[model samples]
Target chain A: MIITKKSYTFEVSPQSVDFNCQITLSSLTDLLLTAAQYNAEENGFGLRKLNNNGLSWVLLRLALEIDYFPLQYETVYIETWIEGVGRASTTRNFCIRNKEMQIIGYAASTWAMIDHQTRRAQDLFTLDNIGDFASEETVPIDKPIKLSERRGVLTDVFSAKYSHIDINRHVNTMRYVEWISNGFSPEHYSRKSVKRFDVNFMSEILFGEEVKVYKTEEAGDTYLFEILHNDKPSCRARLIFRSEK
Target chain B: MIITKKSYTFEVSPQSVDFNCQITLSSLTDLLLTAAQYNAEENGFGLRKLNNNGLSWVLLRLALEIDYFPLQYETVYIETWIEGVGRASTTRNFCIRNKEMQIIGYAASTWAMIDHQTRRAQDLFTLDNIGDFASEETVPIDKPIKLSERRGVLTDVFSAKYSHIDINRHVNTMRYVEWISNGFSPEHYSRKSVKRFDVNFMSEILFGEEVKVYKTEEAGDTYLFEILHNDKPSCRARLIFRSEK
Candidate 1:
């Protein structure tokens, strides 16, 4: 039987750290996404193989919670596995641990496979034996929520450029996370660390396309974001923070 | 004697690739910077150790020339070593090769050690025996040129957010590199591939600070860039591209 669960180890390099010498959220997300891709490839159902079949995977939603962010040069491991697979989507869960094997964070994400030409969802279960790898286990956290559509205060406006597009020919998922994460200030980070983050990608932002990021404070500690491409919604997210001081 | 030269291998992951499935320049620069930090730490002058003394390393100028960019999932190696160390700056060089060990690219960079508190350049020789690692060698490519000041066309404007700042409490070098690289559209990349890139960081841009990027096309294929932070020149760069068609 093919191994469904896979683990990858990584060191928090200097390039991943932020002003506090701790790993930035975007880099952490990168690590998680990397682990997901690696595990999918190990199972022989990765993006490369799917691309050959004229199909592509798109992230639908993601949620992450960290106990404490790791510092620069610290080694960490990420173990990920498919929790469940349905006709339209699949759930992948991750466990993040420090060098000592102590759990530090967890993440859960949902993905959908789509037809490359139609840009429409394809039945994910149709992939031969992809369901065989489902472990039916989940991380110790709330599932990624489906964020509501919001048209908040326009905070940032820009165009997707060459640097923004990824292998799938659209803006990378991590760049969307970055745009949402950037809505807050350094002071907010110093005073509070993200306890939970939920993001939903609705559409793809393409190269040379204009983008507008809207931000709204829904509560004392919860913030919501909507990213619009050419005035059309592309992604939405919510971040929950806990006071550190 | 401790080994001064070091090499690290990396598999180009999905997160690092662009629309063409080839590694992006920013990600490539990240790999080079990662190698520099790893080698420095291996030699006992790493940032973690420097942080204890309120000191840190900063890139001053860098120039990279790639024969062909590696594609996603391709294994590549980067070997780096200190070319020389002076009072205020040090020269480091890199060689990039594919899995078959064929040389594909070369990069040369200049860096300085600065007191984190005062933010002033320090005599690099003051570090214990750091000069011992200087190989006094040079790469085959042209050195990172010292670009002259230019008031070109304003290309991009944005505020440096928390995500832009690195462990040094200011905007990170790679972020600045991305901004400069983002100035050109995808059509430009589709037609031309970078032959050489040179960047000089003149001043630091802190969080919440607004920045403006300017571009000037000189005679031939050379393009010059000037990055201003709140109307003050912060960085400058030159990119030379070769027609791929």
Candidate 2:
């Protein structure tokens, strides 16, 4: 078994969340972003020292599956790696665990190479020569859930900071949910409850990267939300809201 | 009414809970910690920055009341003020909100100033000239609930990071809950479910602060937990475990 040696772990607290006990979803995007940073730093491609030629990896989508949740003061580890990069999108994966290293949650994100200054998506194939970051076998891609199924509000934009980055890697998916969900007024939430939210996690969003979250309330019953790394989509979510508050 | 100009809100999430939607007892401790940061920072006694001469505020106790459960992303404010500095402790208070200025939750915390290097309680009287973070007004303090009434694990020592700090001041409460709750083994949680937890919000832990979470499991029924800042108790909590996996 290929064991994870340093599964970037760190502690996070309540101020981390919007109003929710869970980590915010956008924070999740930030986590994915940090995971990329960790991977990049290990490969000498993360936040560059002198030039400040930062690496900004945009989240394409995120698919999160959680078994049990965590509480405040608990320390967690985010283990991630490049499943491999492809011609179009670079696929990254994540797993959140406890001190015991038990998998508490997992996420899969799709990222695209982008120019830091221009804020333009760089073609992965073209950048293989310049950037030291490259992958050999692009194993599997987390297939985006088909359009025929359910659609809710996808998280649109997220406000982030440098601290959101974990020394521990990636911001954490729950933070993304919190940031995206926070867009909606809490007063509205009490009046409206989230029944089911389907968030397909794609890639990671780094710290201090201001992300725009877009959501199209579909059919007046559910909403389809998308968190974008500029024009490229990062995470798409479908939320079923109820009138409770 | 004195209002804070730079106010932030929150949307509580599922991650804040143990297995139940209720916030983990640990989160209450985080809330207290967060408020303490504000109380300290407003007076220029913020987090440890550059110098060894830093004051690490430790939590003594907390009394909180949840009038109505604050759900995920339910916008709430931790409106806080100091109630003067005692010989050993600084009193802090907070009120939660649902939306814009809507009171939803309320809490109060007592903090002890300590020397970061020595890890021993400091003389609050020395800072007497500064007085408490807030004026001494007889604000109501919530009564502490029985520790047995709470749920979750007596958390064990867990490592944390500096980036966990938020713009507001300390580590957000939700992130703490998420990580701390995640500290337990997935198998342990899958085997024994979290029933209930009640935490007393304590003192704040700022950036670059390394803290330890100590837990004591009692017969798998309840766990006594404490988040120690530099070995001094920052917060206290009680968690209830259930028969589930």
Candidate 3:
């Protein structure tokens, strides 16, 4: 039997939770990506197979809408499936549920297959029946959108260290999320919870490169962030928060 | 039968590994801590129970001696048990085994029970029969020792951010390990793998506190690290790496 979609269960460990006792955005993102990996592997197009062919999947854009953040030791079930496949990119969607099977969040991600050596995007159609896995499913939220460049106040500046680099020799995606999460103070997090998060990866940040994080407060509890390396924007993200009350 | 020791298995995930595809020290530390939590809970002395009494366990010192780092997707079994319980602190030890059931590493950790409100250490003897759970087991490596003050070149300086803080409102121990790991570059990591790691938490680093990390190269593949906040040492660590021949 061919499986087009899959669900994975994860328990929120003590370390993954924040001061509020809820799971942090970065750790949630990790679970989502882990689900994607598992589903992809089960369908036979995972990173291990792609790496053997000198190719790998790279995330381009991601947007998550979460209604409730699961607390520490809570179990979350993430269901993921490929939504569509195009020549240039592919889409994946997720549905997150709590222990009671209540749907609590939705996420959408875009990815592209790239030649590891050339760093060029590969045609999705070239793979053997890769499109067969697309379920044509859609999430309730809008697709991840590109953010326009806006100058913001510098929030942080630091050089990429060894810990930031991943197996791909580039900065890990979770590290970027962590930096964005750090832009807000603990007091801000205490009063507000993240409702929506959208991020777009523009370029790769290599090791030893200095990174500057900028933040601009948008209207209505929205904040924009841009990560720059050598004056080039490497990633941009937007976070929307809702008051706890 | 009452269980005095517990064994937990963890599969190294994609996101928890470094550029070498091996599990990172921070992630390994997380698993050990997780094991500790599980064992404590089963024995009726876990954080959940302690939190109900306005108290929690705080890590004081840890030492890990690893013969190999498990790669991504590799399964590792960690057996943990309480070694002894003193009036002020408790000792816990761990044995790490790979898939073949061969011992790959050992770790020892010291922890103290502290009142959440006063942030003062409490008497371990106060807990009902907490000392009965000690198995008196021992690991081969030396116990976690107190690192002396060493002055070295400043490697990194930054303020504790929101992401660095944990549920206790202090910088997470994993972040401290990361900062110490970041003291070296990719080239250094490519040439050497950590053989032993020892860390001492002298004080807490609260959110927004400026932190300065210093690294001193010692004799024979040894490096010492010190983290300071406002000219006061908050943490000290030692790393010994072996050439990957």
Candidate 4:
């Protein structure tokens, strides 16, 4: 039997670092997604296998909390496993550790398997053995919160291009974080660092589709964002920041 | 004494692969840049050290030719060294090898030192010991072509956003590649793979500035691109593609 729980190690590279020399949020998301993919492949039901059956996996929601962001050239260990497998969705949890093996961050993500052609969620029951991989263990952080509708002011607008689309013909998750992060100016970043992040991916945005990002300040250091396509909500996010000392 | 040459190994992760399961050009470029930064730091003249002295390095031109793209999870090695140093710029060469130690690709790049504050090209001779790092070797590939001005048909237009700007406060080189690659649709990519690429950076693009991309067919399989800002050329590229069999 293939193992479902897996751990991977990586070194923070220069390309993944930001102006502050710490790994950027997008890079952190990439690392988590990479680990998820590795675990999926180890369980005999990866994107490659799903694509062969006219299906693909899509991230629906994610929440991350980091005590400290790793710096360039620092070693990082990510232990990931399936927390639960439901009828049409599943949850994956990650433990992010530093070189000292101390827990530095935790991330949890929700995903859905959808038909590649119809783009409709497929019943997870069809995958007969996927449940075998669920360890039923959970991260000690709150689950990704369901973001409510936000009718905020328009912050930016751009059409999805080739780079935004992934193999499944939808926008890459990190691109969404990039759009959200871009909502702030350099001056804003100079004084603040992200503490926690929550995002809900309600719908898929395809290539060449125009996307408008809306932003509103919910409270002190807390901002909410809604990404709309053709006036329909596609994704929502809430970001909490702390002033850098 | 610092080592002027360096070798690094990396595994092509899922996030770096494209629809064909081969590593995307953008990800490959990121790996190359990462290796360059690592080698520079090992030589004690990295971006951090240079920035401390009010100086920065900027990519001027790059050329890459690959025989086969690596697949996801495949191990690859990159060996890089400074080939030559001139009055104002230096040439860096890279050898890309697959897990079997077979050479798979070769890349060459030229970079210039500039004042961080003035953004003016700095005299390389002023860096007393930089000459000691030149290996005086070459990558056995054609040098990056000096692309002449091309008045191609308009392809894409957008305002440069904050995410496009790197720590140097200018648009990142990979962002330009994205724009140029997006000029071709998914249908185009389905039938062709890039055989070689050459890009030249003539000027820096700033945040929130309007930019346009133009493209022209040079011959049967060669295409030229030029990126303009305020009607002035910022960067140019030439791509040669081979029809996938």
| CA lDDT for candidate 1 | 0.89
User: Taking the tens digit of each residue's C-alpha lDDT, what string does model 3 give over A110-164?
Assistant: 9999998888899999888888888888999989989989769999999998889
On TM-score, the candidate that comes out on top is: 3
**Tens-place lDDT digits, model 2, residues B114-229:** 77556567787766354624565543544445343223344444333323544334555544554446445433553654444455545566544556666666775866766766
TM-score of each: 0.97, 0.40, 0.98, 0.93
Fraction of native Cα contacts kept in each candidate? 0.94, 0.09, 0.85, 0.47
**Candidate 1: stretches off by over 4 Å:** A1-3, B1-3
- Each model's TM-score for chain A is 0.96, 0.58, 0.98, 0.96
Model 3 bad stretches (over 4 Å): A1-3, B1-3
The residue pairs in collision within model 4 are none
lDDT winner between candidates 1 and 3: 3
True contacts kept of 3: 0.85
Q: Score the docking of each candidate (DockQ).
A: 0.84, 0.06, 0.89, 0.57
Instruction: Note the B-chain TM-score for every model.
Output: 0.97, 0.55, 0.97, 0.96
Best by lDDT: 3
**Candidate 4, A118-190: lDDT as tens digits:** 9999998798599877888899889999999986989888788777878887788889998998888766777
Q: In candidate 4, how many Å is residue B35 off?
A: 1.6
lDDT tens digits, residues B1-245, model 1? 34489789988878988777888888899999999988898999998899899899989999999998889989999999999989989999999999899999999999999999899999998899988888888999999999989979998888998888988889988888889888888778788877888999999999888899999998778899999999999999998889863
Compared with the true structure, model 1 gives a TM-score of 0.97
Q: Model 2 chain B: which ten-residue window has the lowest total lDDT? A: B1-10
